[model samples]
Target chain A: MRALVARGLPVDFTWCEGEARARALSEATGAVGRRLDLTDRAALQGFLRAVVDEGAPDVVLHCAAVSQARGLQDLTDDDWDRAVEVNGRSAFALCRALGPAMGARGGGDIVLVGALDRGQTLPLPVHFAATQGMLSAMTMALGKALGPVGVRVNMVALGPLGEGLSRALPASLVEDYRAFSALRRLGTAEEVARVLAWLALENTFMTGRVVTANGGI
Target chain B: MTGRLEGTRCLVTGGSRGLGRELCLAFAREGARVAFTFRRREADAEDTTLRLRALGCEPQCFQGDVADGAHAQAVVGALTRAWGGLDVLVNNAGVQHVVPLALLEEPDWDLMLNTCLKGPYLFSRAALRGMIRARKGTILNVGVFSSERIVEAPAHYAAAKAGLRGLTDALAREVGRHGVRVNMLSPGLLDVGLGRMLMPHRVEEYRAQAALGRTGTAEEVARMAVFLVSDENTFMTGARVTPDGGL
Candidate 1:
């Protein structure tokens, strides 16, 4: 994407990854990276307002989340709210809020992250599936509605990404995870980031769509 | 960014129109040798090929009806033979009969099922032979929103897309050990040639109910498809992407 910007496309970005990372991204791409905790409604809206004020962003990419692999009973309402708020709700809010500007401008793109959890259930992490299922619905409805405005919506579904929350799993689960992936291995951040970049930057015609970037499955 | 499919050979179905045409152009831009199938429009195929060739990419078009068996075999076989080695098969040829599920016609049901479901199966069955031989290949099936949502489609279309999703997962596992990756590229409301017809309203009606308040384009979906087929996505399978703007 930086390369595309360098090639002279008017590029802008607002990252919620955190202050330092967001700042680095802003510097690398010359994009306005606003570091707002996506879960904080007030902060998110305010920050996005400021971003819209500064200059309307034509594309909005929701890439923030909190993950935990607790058992079913171990899951709590707080976790649900947090997951919903952070992982999925933030996207809903951003689109709900900032979509008008892009539409008014006559065009833009919004891409979210999804998972296979909606269809296939895993061992203990059901919340991930639940929110993702809602997220999928939102993607579909939004696509139909927003397509007329030239504001495209889409999602890149994900599989397990790392050894962080996953390494602590049972050996059997780990084996299952490995075998479940078409590549039979773990994915890397560069790999995931590349996907994010593609959904945001290239292939301009696809919207209200879901493309699984989960290796080969 | 490195153009992972730089020299890989690819074949995309429904290349005579919309998302298929966009995929052909994008792949050619990325330095891939492409062989895309067109059902009957030799003119559209030529236009696509002309555009691809203008990009300094090798492109060829074949004629075949995805709904038929012999044509599918000949087309898939021809592509595999032309390149001497095929690396990616994008099974994307599909048709939709969008109506209130309650009012969908029986013939429309068959059209939906045969085009979306049967096409992928036939193409995959044929492509898998060469892929397993090479021990490396990618199957990117273009699916629909019906797989995840019960949008107003004939039961057949929805069921077929749902089945396609399942096929992607199961096939991903079945061929994982063979070094083959199976994936589905499911687009929601899109701005491609078909989307313009699917929901002809001005779209505000749809937006009022949508979470994202908009539709997407074929290029964006194509980009996602390309990334999935790229080398970077090395550990994901049985995944579904809802590129619908936050619906």
Candidate 2:
């Protein structure tokens, strides 16, 4: 979000709005932040309408995710429900609310930032993987639906962040990841932000695709 | 004058003619100290060098087959020695033989795969050494539009191009931590290079099919190529950007 501001792009923040971090970021960036629970479809729709009332943006980025991880054995129905509501359902809700307007405008870009689990050989948290997979499918389907109308739908699949996970992981594990990659490193948030900006702004012909942003994982 | 890639040390493979030639010219115009590979066309390479010089950029020309690992090593070695370190690499050397799979011989298949797939792989391997140390570099691989489909006669060509997607994704993930980016640029039918000769009978049909109702220009593709490797592209890696005028 800060990276986008640095690039001189106008950005609006929309989330459940309780975290001090989100509030501070919004204040620091002078971005309009909305407090809307994505689980409620009507609230999500209303929030988007309010966004349009402020200003119809050239790009609407869906970067929200419930960063909860639980193995399949310990997962319950509620866990699945929470994951679906936060990660999977909200993406579709945004598309349904915003897709038509963007289409009517003759062109717009919708970039969904998804999780790193892309059927990799390694084991993953079942619910997180499921929602991520769902989001990936929806991105492709929406991309095809909106492509002819000039609205581009794309997804950016990211791996562990350099600032977040890299700081927490042990040095040995970090080195393991590096050895796994050809470039041998993790990705920075600025790098991912740059990709989102490019897809939204500079990309001319690319549509209906997943731009993977994992360091060669 | 000052450009986005000013003072950048760059190398482009198979830059004697066609789309590759345009890429070389465009890079030179952007203030990059450019070195390009030519397999056999000495005259074309000389002409390209002269054109770069006209643009006020000192351009180096190397003759080698990128598919041969030794030649790829030599190309990278010479560039590193001349320019100190390589910042950008465009894997554009490619060859195609438009023949049916039934008639495609072992050597022909080898030629297509080796040039299109193995060449990029070998060059990327060599380039990564310096790039890893620098912790900042960009690699662009040139591919055809039919990367995911079988629209042309040469199945081997399509296969080779498709293989690049894997290479791009895998390499991007591995080197991204190092601040290096790798991407594939798949261009659609153009009025230049081998595209002019590819499916000559069906060129008009392909043009008509595009949303723009025309074939793309090499300059158009070159512009996108520059943007992909430029400083402006901060977040794009493991991506295959196709500028086929919406085919």
Candidate 3:
């Protein structure tokens, strides 16, 4: 929200798991923030309808994902379902709902935000990497399916950053990530957000691509 | 000289028909003690069994859902008890639905993900215990090449197969030190199983795009699959081998 607003783009809506955080984001970025459970299909459809009614946005940036570090033996069906629903299925829903509308109106962009660990040998949960893979492939398929309609879909895969899920990782793991990168340092959220903004706003003739911002990892 | 998979104990999921059945026949011919899983395909399973028997190899067929953890565990346990240990596993069962995203429903998405992605995860998790213990095993996941290319395919199918690719990479890295090799085989536009469902013009389009000027066959892909899981596959893991005729 802050990144788009900083680019002089009006932020229409934002969603999170917590009502308080949603309200804080709304206040901070002047975008309508709502608490949304992505696992609820009805709620997601309603939200999509509301957004479409508000005039199909020029750019749809999907950055929402749920991940947990669990070993294969410890991961349950529920864990798998949660990650797939929030990380994989929700992104598809967003694209399916907003893509045709944007395409019909001449052109638009849809940028999916993913983690670099999807292609790495990280010790992250299988579900996390799997959902990231799903998102990446969906971006490619949608790019081809919607391109004729003038909607360009791409993905921005972020490396270990100093914010969000990286902070939740173990200190040792974080240090390893820092060492694994060519820059020898973790990236900032702003850096990733800038990449997302560029893909969503400025880029043309580049569809169905995964632009990695992983500090050369 | 002995067969490539001589004395090997292998299990293939969804081996009743399509590429799975072809893989089973290939493995059996290579002297593997083959066991396969089928879901509600008694006739197909019987045919596969008869063919394997004619090849002079006894094949075991288990009927169950690949996505069920308990069933996966039970299948692995049976194989382990019967053959002492399982040397190879092929996650080859999958279903395809070609609806557009606008018409795709939750059930379709779940069905695809459950079969193509979670089934592999469940079976791999179940089999990994024995593989890690024995310090020797190979897992070959069947994937689709269309996921990596700009072809007309359902998002759900692409997502599921791509997710399997991710699982293959991560699991390979996790267990490589344990002497287990994991790889994915992505075949493109074959003339069997789901590929037979494509329109004639689409098939012609795919063939024209291929460097080989033709689509691939399941038997040709099965040959590659045999080599990947055989002793010949030493020193290769965390890799994706595409037998898609250069598509």
lDDT of all predictions, in order shown? 0.73, 0.78, 0.80
Best candidate (score: lDDT)? 3
Q: A1-217, model 1: which lDDT tens digit per residue?
A: 4544654666665555457866777778776544567777899889778766776677777766565777788889988888888878888878877777788887788888666534455674767667777787887677777776778788777766673344545677767867765677766655666666666666454566666665554
DockQ of candidate 3 compared with the true complex: 0.01
Complex DockQ per candidate: 0.33, 0.25, 0.01
Worst 10 residues of 1 chain A by lDDT: A160-169
Tens-digit lDDT string for candidate 2 (A131-185): 8889888877787676666777778887666774236445665677667754565
Report the number of the highest-DockQ candidate.
1
| lDDT tens digits, residue span B100-211, model 3 | 8999999999989999999999999999999999989999999998776778877899899999988977787678767787888888878786678877888888766554
- Displacement of residue B167 (Cα, Å) in model 2 is 5.0
Candidates sorted by DockQ, best first: 1, 2, 3
Better of 1 and 3 by TM-score: 1
CAPRI-style docking class of model 3 based on DockQ: incorrect
Candidate 3 or 2, higher lDDT: 3
- Which residue pairs show collisions in model 3? none
- Model 2: pairs clashing at backbone N, Cα or C within 3 Å: A181-B174, A182-B174, A183-B174, A183-B175, A184-B174, A185-B177, A215-B173, A215-B174, A216-B173, A216-B174
Q: Write the per-residue lDDT of candidate 2 for residues B1-247, one digit (tens) a residue.
A: 2397998888999998888889988888888889999999999999999999999988888898889999999989988988889999999998856777898899999988899999999999999999989988999999888885556536888899899888887788777877898988888887686576676668877765554446778886886677678876765577667666455
Tell me how far the alpha carbon of residue B117 in candidate 1 is from the true structure, in angstroms, after superposition: 4.0
lDDT of 3: 0.80
Error of 2 at A24 (Å): 2.4
